[model samples]
Target: MSNNGDVFVIGGVEHMGHVGMMHGVDPNPHMSLYAAKASGMMGLTAEMLGKMHGITREAQDAFGVRSHRLAHQATVEGNFKDEIIPMQGYDENGFLKMYDFDETIRPETTLESLAALKPAFNPKG
Candidate 1:
């Protein structure tokens, strides 16, 4: 038990070598969201498991809506400040800006809006 401020982190099976490096996929690229999907580690597995679990599209949409709502709520309640590092920079217009919150989340998201979204990777949809 020591408190020298050093932290050790371990990740599991999240590397290209773990998936055996399939076709069109990289042999040494870092494990990323796109890589995971291309490597059939998440895209196919998630779809199959989600269907097996009987999680309907509407349920997935509802969960996404809830996630965005909770994220927005956390931002408004100032809880986001604790989890993120502050960013201060200029936009494309060269105007200086200080970003302190998550601007991507929308608390006003609805089920209908989420339902409109289609699967991006799957072509059979």
Candidate 2:
């Protein structure tokens, strides 16, 4: 929602409702994970990124760092506690009760690691 304009185009492409032209997907609800991952890995077209937001490499790096931080914060603040399902579910009565939050959120992502990641999108070398 923060980047509405960018999301809009991707959403519009989805709203077109053409399956054949869309790589065998109905572009109305949500894009397939395969498509999203492929697109993410392949990176965005220069024209597409340009039309959405004038994001630079530096900005992208900062965004990634901030996103990691936000995830950590959300977990720490118990905002996602309800969303988590704990393991070892059997209680004394053999009833399943969740007792912990998922600890998959990374709070220690470094700038070096972020820099090492491949670019998700770019315009020119």
Candidate 3:
């Protein structure tokens, strides 16, 4: 629920974040140009680039787990107080809502759980 009396709930969508803006024009050929193949090529390119630097799924997942853990720890320890600004407002139903921290972090993620995910970019893997 938003402060503007609009009830907003996020459903699940993955590729929308990548192939979303189909009508927009940009200097990057990746945007609005070859919209269908853009995502695959971009991911493959990124995976190749990472491979050049010796980054594998294990390394990537380890970094992600470490990242979430560090981020949660930092937030809990008030390390981001200087950068974070708390916002207080009313919900769509007029209930008071206070937001002071990141809500998207999965702090309890484990390396084993992360390993369950298939490598999307690395086709050979």
Candidate 4:
């Protein structure tokens, strides 16, 4: 997951393409280098690195809150207007609508809300 490699996609019929990668997972444990030391999930790796660097949960939550605040502010200021392309997607009620803004951006996210989230990779942590 932490390999510095390049991926090439060979084109074919619509949506059908072959992806070639310089690095990937190996089935054999004895031949694998990072399989035992690192997790396949990036979140788990990030958590491990954070713990190694002495980054506390409170600090992480505060950072997440700050990031959400900045993203929300940028969206309100129309900073992403030129960057985002409006796409047609279905709503929760199956109504089709054009989405211009990032739907995943949670403007209401706060440190309290983030702190309430359990560790996704290691629950005990």
What lDDT would each prediction earn against the true structure? Answer: 0.68, 0.57, 0.69, 0.72
Ranking by TM-score: 4, 1, 3, 2
* 53-97: candidate 1 lDDT, tens digit per residue: 676778777878998989888888889687777799887899999
Best by TM-score: 4
**How close to the true structure is residue 29 of candidate 3, measured as C-alpha lDDT?**
55
Candidate 2 lDDT, tens digit per residue, 1-109? 2364563322112333433333543444355454552453213444355446676656666776887799889888989778666666666799987768544456787
Model 1 clash number: 0
Tell how far residue 96 is off in model 4, in angstroms: 0.4
Per-residue lDDT tens digits of candidate 4, residues 6-73? Answer: 76554333321243222343546574364554553355567777777787888888877887889899
In candidate 1, which residue pairs clash? none
> Residue 92: error of model 1 in Å?
5.4
TM-score of 1: 0.60
The predicted structure with the larger TM-score, 1 or 4, is 4
Per-prediction TM-score to the true structure, in the order listed: 0.60, 0.44, 0.54, 0.68
* Candidate 2 whole-model C-alpha lDDT, 0 to 1: 0.57
Query: Is 1 or 2 the stronger prediction by TM-score?
Result: 1
